[model samples]
Target chain A: MMRLVLGLVVGVMMIGQVAQAQNQPLRLEITEGVIEPLPFAVPNFVPANAAAAELSSDLARVVAADLIGTGLFREIPSSAYISQITDFGAPVQFADWKAINAQALVTGSISVSGNRVTVGFRVWDVFSDKEMKPGLQFSGTKEGWRRMAHKVADAVYSRITGEGGYFDSRVVFVSESGPKNQRRKRLAIMDYDGANVQYLTDSSAIVLAPRFSPTGDRVLYTSYESGFPRIYVLDVGKVQRRVLESQEGTMSFAPRFSPDGQKVVYSLSQGGNTDLYLMTISNGQSKRLTSTPSIETAPSFSPDGSQIVFESDRSGSPQIYVMATSGGEAKRISFGNGRYGTPVWSPRGDMIAFTKQNKGRFHIGVMRANGSEERLLTASFLDEGPTWSPNGRVIMFMRETQGASGRSSLYSVDISGRNLRPVQTPDGGSDPAWSPLQK
Target chain B: MNLVSKLIAGCALMALAACNNPTDGTDGGPIDPNAGTTSPGLIGDQTSPSYFQQAIGDRVLFTVDQSTINSEAQSILQAQANWLLANTDYNATIEGHADEQGTREYNLALGARRANAAREFLISKGIAGNRLKTVSYGKERPIEICSEESCYAKNRRAVTVLLGGLAG
Candidate 1:
């Protein structure tokens, strides 16, 4: 009996030890508080070679520009910096950074050998006095120095925000000019910050809705060169293009690439009836996806190729619908009072961005995949055609003025319905398509 | 034959042909020599392009965001059909347009519906379908550039343009 009592006592002690080992820090409490932008410092990169002397400082400036543009972070100018970082290998002076009230510090170095260049960068948390992430390096041609800088900024952003970075990306949009009645449209591409502007097509034929391929090598757009709307695929690097083979007496428009980039989904109008169609990019083989008499267009594929989210007027008014890629009945996802169209699925596959019109006002909005938790990000005289940033944290769309001027420009807003701002462009722009992150 | 006698014979033959085929409305209505005097208006006859535009009307309007042809639009379309029937030598191209209110793709499809609605009605009114073609400009081309309802009502329309031939 004494041995049994001793065994019970030992079991109780073991249970107490297990419970104590499972103890964790108290969960963070929910409360309202003032939100302020985080302050960070980006020291000019060290030049390891004579050729990289100028590029080193230029790269650092570009990196700082990217982080500040997001509005989530602020840059502490070099004038306020307590100490300079002269060597990338040297330890970070956390006390100096903390003296300037900087929460994060970014340091890097650049080296140019022959035609190739290498950039290495590191990020540190000042209060913690430790590296935020492992230092990383990128190598590329001398011409791509800016891209490498953007890559460094992207890494820093991802580490700090706990979300993917959109710095290292491109945007393809329709550039507009001339008067409101006879606007001339040309296809133009540039960096996400409106740099490196390149015109892909002239204003001879009207172009609309340029979509980037999954690999960022090609773009799909609708052109009126044949006196009717037809889809054309253009190679970004080669600047060569070819019209997608289509049946005679039919019009095709609103083209989008499948997630895999091997197929295109667009709307085909045959004998006055418009429906959704899927076509292989290589051989021109196509299959009909929707057969309703009503118009079905603006199709976007889910990150996975299993389903598609598109706009259809089959329910009498324009609304968002989700259907299988193989073709089946579409479940209506938008039941709000307003008409919803231009449904684009987010890359994260958690939400779908759309254009909604209600009470004569247009709004850019997002909803969960199953159509719950709808939030309107921006409202304007005319707002439509949303394109998600590479990270899916921001939505870029077209916004137009109210009066007879009828000028249109590209604008972006965070998915959480803040930081609404216009994206700068040389001329009036619309129908922006965000490219995937570069390799 | 003598030169004088031959000339007289030719003149006599021309006079006889002219008498046989009289110029019925060949003057193409009056020259309207006073066209710009009392009023600087309408310098052409019934068959002129300006006359067709001013007298018969070239476009029909619809309600906001709708493609259905109401009674007023149907009356205008009926007049258009009659005019087209009278001018069989000419072909028509119907351009569908929308206001600046809707989404681009939806406006395109709506404009197509408007144009097709008008084309089908013209065909039903005995106008040959082959003589008519339809295209939707969507919201790209706006005749009334203002943003008010007054302008939008005029902007949502289908215009029938005469192409001057029967060829496709």
Candidate 2:
């Protein structure tokens, strides 16, 4: 048995040598950059039935757009392909893809029945001449065809990059219109790529800081309809809402959902003093988390729901702090020269993204959960409210230009401080809170 | 500042003469029905809303990111306090605002501080606490349109809007 194992190890080494002599599999280490993007091709998905003829092709297009938008993968246009994939189950002609320098290939098929749709996809490492992963399929309502496409793209991304995917997600934000003084803000939600925008609230009253629930079925936001800041919870699908009860004279704002969606942590001000409070959603009871005289707000929960991160000015300036979920002695985490606020815990539980203000400039930055290895992504005149993508690989925040004509817009930057791009909205937007990956 | 003050005084004097000349009827025209309706006592009343707004200055300015009242803002609030004291039938809502330079939450808290600072001063000057209410608009309401210091100076202000007062 030992001799057989020895011979197998030697054979594996020889195969590795032969693989290196040929083209090795496409391995992307995110830390290394300036490298060429992986080249891949996705033929228009095949339609399994007459009802799926157009949707199959559209779903493939959306999947391709999702992968290509990452800037890590480049799609070889159909014009450049020498062969077409007519059969989803047929053997892949790796030789043809190899000739075109296509390192990876994705082939998918779609089927529709009634209000249901299904997408099946497979990824192949053409260079290694082998399938990278087992075939996968997703079935959902036809109304959510885009989500099915996102799932397929996410599968391909995770299989290739060895990281979680953020494609199948949503963002809740405050959409602004009109002039600066008379600006009307409403709660708006959209897909991760800023498509399918739906206004959850009207522009009747000013709204700020729309945050998504853990399940993405509801949202928490602060509205001024009551002539003062009050937190309200709205069901995303039903569009029904109710104000969260609090003390009569106190104001509540800057709310975020706990990871379990069972409670909410927010800031409440009374008698000109602000503090953090945690409330159980099942019951209307709330417990004060911080009792300092200084302002305390912008509370976010760690993914495990064991601790809370918030911003406080009790130490003389607004800085990030961490405390037990049940409220106890807090420890300051930000020792930087400038003030810090809006610290959002990454879903991965490794880092926290925040907005830092320093010598006449603002930046969207991230630091380790313990407040180490701090890195700034983008700097501008006014960049605030940093929220992590569902996968924690990207951050979305709001930036406003300087001067009178200044308008707010949403911007995202990769965690590596690259691929900074503006998310186009119908009008000005701010306070983006990215939702978790959709079910 | 001096030029604006002089301009305001000149305008007030012209308004006074305009009020008197309307009653003088030196043009010898038929007695205008509207002339009898023009009551200088009500129009120029020190406790009137227009006088409080145009003459006493309904708003006070604050420095960048700080809520501590300067002497100039204190003088304005002091005059406001005197007005509120003389007109016991009036209640005011102090709306604190910040320029579009800071984070929304921080600016909200800062605006609250500015409003509280003004409110505390008014209370110190014998204005009843129950008569004053405070709210922070926090960079949402900007009176000026520019982004420079001149505009920001106007944007970071606390305006004392009279409410629930006696009828004119």
Candidate 3:
């Protein structure tokens, strides 16, 4: 098996002098309100060998982009730097970085040995003049420098934010083109940063909601190949797929993988009524989860796999509900005025991201697992399908324009309801499902 | 499409009665049959698909997030059922669609419910279940592009598209 990446035990560790400037550890956690973004600096990663020269700056750029994109950290322009970092072991001139209002500093090195490359990086608390995190290194193929850079960025982000890193992840979504009425859709995968996009299915078949497996190797999606919406699973790397549902009369869609990745939960429409069903991926055996006459779909499993949260119209209008994985009476969690759907359990297991429609406008919002503390993160003409980032700190969703010339595109927002930004895609994108950080 | 094309298509259906008739209707007035034979369209031609579209109505509108058949929808479905019985060879693929107002999955389910609502209405009127198929495009397909309620009401619709060759 070709493992794409592996972490290496650094033979040489830079043990800093551990300067004392502040009592509290360096962190960028902001609660309840917006503040100025923390300013940081990333000098170009130094190429340790001649072979790594051309790609060193590119590596540093990706790291900087990942950190800046979060809206939590701002990069102090290199032009404003008083001192330049040329080596990984060079001690951080805290006074110089502090003079430029830099709270954190990052230094990295790229060493190439044939097709294999090793990347080592360190984060420094510029104010304290102490190491923010222990030095570490990642080794991978030269062609995968981007992933290596992402890994570095992930480490830096996590060390400062005290949260899991989402940079080293992928998103499976439907790439759309043409007009709103006659749209052409295909299954496409891309890096979380919208880089290295690769198509998984041709536009001949209409595809939607390409959700990633827990392991991030396979994807579950809905397609209209047989002139009916059906669930399908595709091996992302191989670009091979097969129909997961083949019932004669029923049409299935809105599929998701269980937390264990052993079973699938999807909605099956039979005789005009929709309900949720669980199917074992190994044996293709099925079990009915809900027997509701109302529309029951968009099932997402909790991180613990003990329960499933889904949207159902059993309460008259569509509302978020929580029921056991084994099935029973679902407790309605959303009691607000608007209709709520697409409730996704956050990976952190504390929040559920969802889509809401009220007063002709749509919103992406989050609430506690029990539906308390409802917070709308974004509102737009048409915003739907909230997908949590791997860290559960951000939510990505599709926003579509109105009319025949209208189109759909992806946007994301921090869970705090700040920093709403568009996620760039080559073509229109919708139904984004973010994968867990890649192994 | 742009405002010009949207206006033309809306005018063709007479849905936007405010638009001026191309056949020299004075200042946004109704079309005159005497001005041009084609201007009358195939509304009176009962045997044609255009007749089904322009007269009997091949589509029905639903209120925001509703699948229940309203009174007007019931009347139209009655006409549709009578037409289907008269035109025995026709089968329809009921395309259910939602406005850009809901989640993709829920809108898809909503569309399904709307399509099935129409299908059940037809079946109640003695149409065969095998002769009807349903698909929901959710918010993916919108006939009207405006973000306002005017266009949203039109986009929230279920259209019964006729297939001529298949005589099931």
Among incorrect, acceptable, medium and high, the docking class of model 2 is acceptable
Comparing only chain B with the true structure, the TM-scores of all models are 0.71, 0.73, 0.73
Across A285-328, the per-residue lDDT of candidate 3 in tens digits comes to 98999997889999999999889999998878889999999999
Better of 1 and 2 by DockQ: 1
All candidates: TM-score: 0.86, 0.87, 0.88
Q: In candidate 3, which residue ranges exceed 4 Å CA deviation?
A: A1-5, A14-23, B1-51, B164-168
Compose the digit string of candidate 2's lDDT tens values, residues A51-151: 88879788888888888777788888889888898877777788899889888898888788987777777788888877765667777778788887888
**B1-168: candidate 2 lDDT, tens digit per residue:** 343344434544555433222233222222212113222223354544456666778788988877888999888888888777656656777778899877888777777778888888999999989887777878888878677889999989888876533331
iRMSD per prediction, in order: 1.1, 1.5, 1.8
In model 2, how large is the Cα lDDT of residue A401? 81
Q: Show pairs that collide, candidate 2.
A: none
- The Cα local distance difference test for each model comes to 0.80, 0.80, 0.83
lDDT of 2: 0.80
* TM-score leader: 3
- Which residue pairs collide, candidate 3? A402-B145, A403-B145
Task: Report the error of model 2 at residue A22, Å.
Answer: 6.9
Error of 1 at A200 (Å): 1.0
RMSD of each: 12.8, 9.5, 8.2
